[model samples]
Target: MNVSLNEVEATAKRAARGAGYPWGLAEEVGKATRWLCAHGIDGTNSLAQLLEQGLAASLKNHRPVEMQSAWAGQGVLCPIITGALLSDRSDLLHAGPIRIQKLAVPVFLLPFVASAARAQNIVITHTCDLFRAATDGDRLEAGQDWPSFSDHTQITLGGQLTTPRPHVTRATPDPACWDTLNRFAHRTYAPATEESRLLGAGAGLSDND
Candidate 1:
């Protein structure tokens, strides 16, 4: 219910870590989830599903491959890593419009698209009328309409990029999203002992701290 964006981002990060992502990748997932909510996409649900399906653990052999017209991988690809890689590789756009055959959470790729566009000096076009990438990634401007979900996503690069207007009011993730993420994150915590409970975070004025 009406959670803060910071809360959403933090929770997503913790959940990713719980689900076995490295801290760096978990940080990317957190930022991506926050970015998705900023643009009116259901990143919380997307991430929740990604973890629920155990895609993170299943990714031993499902690394992304550059396809004829799309990027594909066995099983489902981690959107956070895929997006990060795509942004870093500025030359991949030369292969024409690229599609991810099965992006577990394509919503997480939007911000990376913007960043990639800036890096490659090109514009990223999607099926929607509202992807607003600010000159600075932190200053992004989200609008009314964002892309809808699908099994696959196609990305086209062209023309000069424009700055999008920032969303006026912040959006909150559904409670179900938080609940699901929390359940996942719970797996990371050790079973609390008496000392762990009473002296949480730092032993609160106790010498043992």
Candidate 2:
């Protein structure tokens, strides 16, 4: 069934939170998912797969660490965390390309790259064996081979502009994927109690002013 971008973002945020991410990161996840869905990508499925794979268990272990000339994670890197870092440190992109190893759900990184690109007023190109894409915060272009994950990822600033693409207002997620997301999101709700139910979703059941 088709859902509005707002619903997608809200569900994604709650799902991320329920999957053990803090509110701040979950908010980012929501925006990223909305961006992907708007651009014709299966973002809910990607996030569902990531969460289902137990990647969300210990996020700290997946953080990217700087080595001699590149960043490597102790385990596979969480794209949302790494992507947030990329947006936070966008200025470093000017010095040289940033190479990240063992990144999971690499497509999730595109939204953050777009944010970085918009901040720096330049188009950013992300290249790897699985995919090649360029974004300028608004326009986006990705290869047909863009996979769900990548072993190594590299991103460089200042690429040629891509054609403006129309964005969608509603997204049609896979039914199974939507159910998976909803299950995760269900954790965020407080259990309904008799007392609360009597209150009828407001301060009281009374209609009197």
Candidate 2: C-alpha lDDT: 0.86
lDDT of 2 by residue, 57-111 (tens): 8988888876448878789889999999999999989899999888888888999
What are the per-residue Cα lDDT tens digits for candidate 1 across 8-86? Answer: 7888899998988888988888887887777666678778877776667766545586666677776667777777887
Tell how far residue 45 is off in model 2, in angstroms: 1.5
Residue 153 of model 2, lDDT score: 89
Clashes of each: 0, 0
Model 2: clashing residue pairs?
none
By TM-score, who's the top model here?
A: 2
TM-score of candidate 2 on Cα atoms, chains taken together = 0.91
Which residues of candidate 1, in runs, are more than 4 Å off? 66-69, 127-152, 159-169, 198-209
How far in Å is the alpha carbon of 121 misplaced in model 1?
4.0
Cα lDDT of candidate 1 equals 0.69
Model 1 poorest 10 in a row by lDDT = 127-136
